[model samples]
Target: MALKSPRFASNAALQNAARSAPPIRRGANGQHVAAIQQAFIDLGLGMAISTKKAGKADGIFGGETESRVWQFQARMGLTRDGIVGRDTMAKLDELLPTAGPPPKPLPPAKMTHKINVHMRSIDNPTVPEFTQLKVMEEIYAQYLIRVDVLTGQSVGLTPGEQFTLNIVDGDCKWDQVSDEQRLLQNSGSNQGVGVNDIVVYFATVLREKNGETLQGCAGHAPTRPAVMIAASATDKTTMAHEVCHVLLSSSFTPVHVGEDANLMCSAPMCTGQPAYLSVAQLNRVFASKLLHKL
Candidate 1:
């Protein structure tokens, strides 16, 4: 879900501030944004990071950029509005000396010793970014069914289950992952020697507005399973998407390619194979939910 009201007083004020200095986009998807925030770090402005505010609907300027700028202002004791005024600019000059024209940022790392052309942008714009998250519960359930049929593992894919299930909202941020978040986010976590412990199930929505085929998206992680809805997603479809992935995750068993599980749900858009997938062929068990949805 996202905020409905315009968080800023006027788009003009936001526009003027952005024209002077554009808001830096930062996130796992937007490396350029991260690098720009790093510039603030270099400037000794307090911590500057991306907020979960969606950039597509509202605009990048008024969302994370403003949030980060406001943080900078707070650290500088300027009114905590996300506008980077002259004082903030001066502070930037004082703290971080102009590094010789911002160093070119390294591109998103990829595992390309030898490559297949099937790879796509992990950070590319996802279509239909919002839906009725309430439905993802069913998606997750169906995902579980798929996994059981595929893997034959002893986990619940039906209405009854041994483990308690929960669905919550918030980022499963590996770094800032709270005890609760740790349970939901799969990346950078402790899954046994040969277990995936997580899966991401995405449903195709075929949305007219965004031309997106996905109704919603959700993750079946080690500690918690999460549901994220795409715009206007129906209740049943949303739930089914996420449920499918959860079942998949629980069903997979790792045979060990290099040193990790054979299957991975999060597509590795990076240089490291084990970061998401394994090196060995038989040892791997990959989920094609996103692939199938696409």
Candidate 2:
């Protein structure tokens, strides 16, 4: 029997079928099967289904289609049952681009926070301070909050404070004060930082007593909020992460989360572009004294 080419009224129709259709397996034949096959092809999995010829997606679920389903399931870490069930369908929907209007822009900011930046004279960060501030603005904007730069300056460091700020024991305990951190925060280096403004210092290195290098830290003397960022660790998201630490404060237990998508995830592991803050984290951020009405 000659096979009929898969057909759909439109891409939206195909997407609808792929999303709402019931489970499909081998022996199935029609537009629903075709939708799934087409979705695979759309996701660059056409080679598995194109047995007869390239780009050929017949409205038939045979051995080739079943094999394709298995391959997709494995790739998505779903059960390799060769059936397009709810889980498999959901994964496909997530990967496929939506066919619809663009998302609406967020409304104006309702609240604002300020940051005071101080960079060591010898430090050269990979991500510039201005660019880092912009990234922070974008991340906080989701909560209708605006981040403003209160001040930015380059401070000359003494022989001891230059290049690397030695952290005692490499411990970032908020309650325990490290001499380096205390000196840096109280040594007038954070000049121009108001009580309500968060202070950020960019240093070339943040080395621990044990020879380990840290990307950044939020540890400071009691009642003094500050963030220290290492030049080597200044990715687009590091500043936000450290500032979030100060906002969250030592009272927030379980400071680090396991999910890489979260902003609180420890550095070198968090990979989310502009990592997101959870609802719980947002609540804490709003409660911080640094946040003020616009």
Candidate 3:
């Protein structure tokens, strides 16, 4: 069956309903809840919400609906409370109109790269693994490059490994291999990480020698190319930023760019901007040893 466009009296009405006592939460059933569910589906989140027998939004708020709400909240940087409150309602109102029909599937890409992610069990990353992968996929799709997750897993860490997880004084020295970095990168179980694949470690905390915390860093052993991401900094763009570092490598002079919208911009400045790459940067990325022609 075709998806029916969601109808609401008005954004004001939706907000009013969301502000009502008791709130619109799980187990509630009505057109309002269905509208929210349909909004998620329209936003290309159908895989997470469509579990009903008919595989459609059924005006029922169940486990699937609640999970979808949590995912949506995570994406919007809202509290993942699984409730449609004032804030969630506002975000829904702000984004729903832009949530047109999902894009048609694309043909096979001419170039591709594999990402091997090892997430620490203790890290408890803010953004979910699948969400992070989706973000990377969307950013790279613009360049006609396909980003594939070669392996993803949660692994426990030893006390010693946990203690030394932070990049110390000499760890960020990109010119030579650092022991601290090598130990951390090789601490977790290997997931068939290939020479050409980019390895990403979602650690509990990625700190600099100066005691400043970092969102993500592309520091790795000479042979093992990887990026370390702080659990708290797993926003939509951090992974992409670090991955760009790996692709650019040390040969690219001035690794960090000054443009806020560019992917290579320094942290915090690049926080909320739309990630973009220039023609010259794309040329550098395509020339990397890791990116392969499909």
Best by TM-score: 2
Q: Arrange candidates by lDDT, highest first: which order?
A: 3, 2, 1
- Residue 4 shift from truth in candidate 1, angstroms: 41
Candidate 3: which stretches are off by over 4 Å?
1-122, 166-171, 175-177, 267-274
Best by lDDT: 3
Q: Report the Cα lDDT for residue 222, model 3.
A: 69
TM-score of each: 0.22, 0.59, 0.57
RMSD of each candidate relative to the true structure: 19.2, 12.1, 14.5
**Which model is ahead, 2 or 3, in terms of TM-score?**
2
Instruction: Quote model 2's TM-score.
Output: 0.59
> Candidate 3, residues 1-294: lDDT per residue as tens digits?
112224444444355655644457877887678778887777655533343456767888765566567656656667766777767776666555344653442233343444344443346678765677777776676455678776677656677766776433334556364566566567665668778887777777765667787777787766777887777884668888888888888778778767555667665746323355654566677788888776
lDDT: the better of candidates 2 and 3:
3
Which lDDT tens digits does candidate 1 get at residues 128-244? 222212233222221121211111111222232112113323332211333322332332222331232233322222222334333434333445443333333433333333333
In model 1, the Cα lDDT at residue 64 comes to 35
Taking the candidates one at a time, how many backbone clashes does each contain?
Answer: 40, 0, 0
In model 3, residue pairs whose N, Cα or C atoms come closer than 3 Å (at least 3 residues apart or on different chains), thus clashing, are none
**Candidate 3: C-alpha lDDT:** 0.64
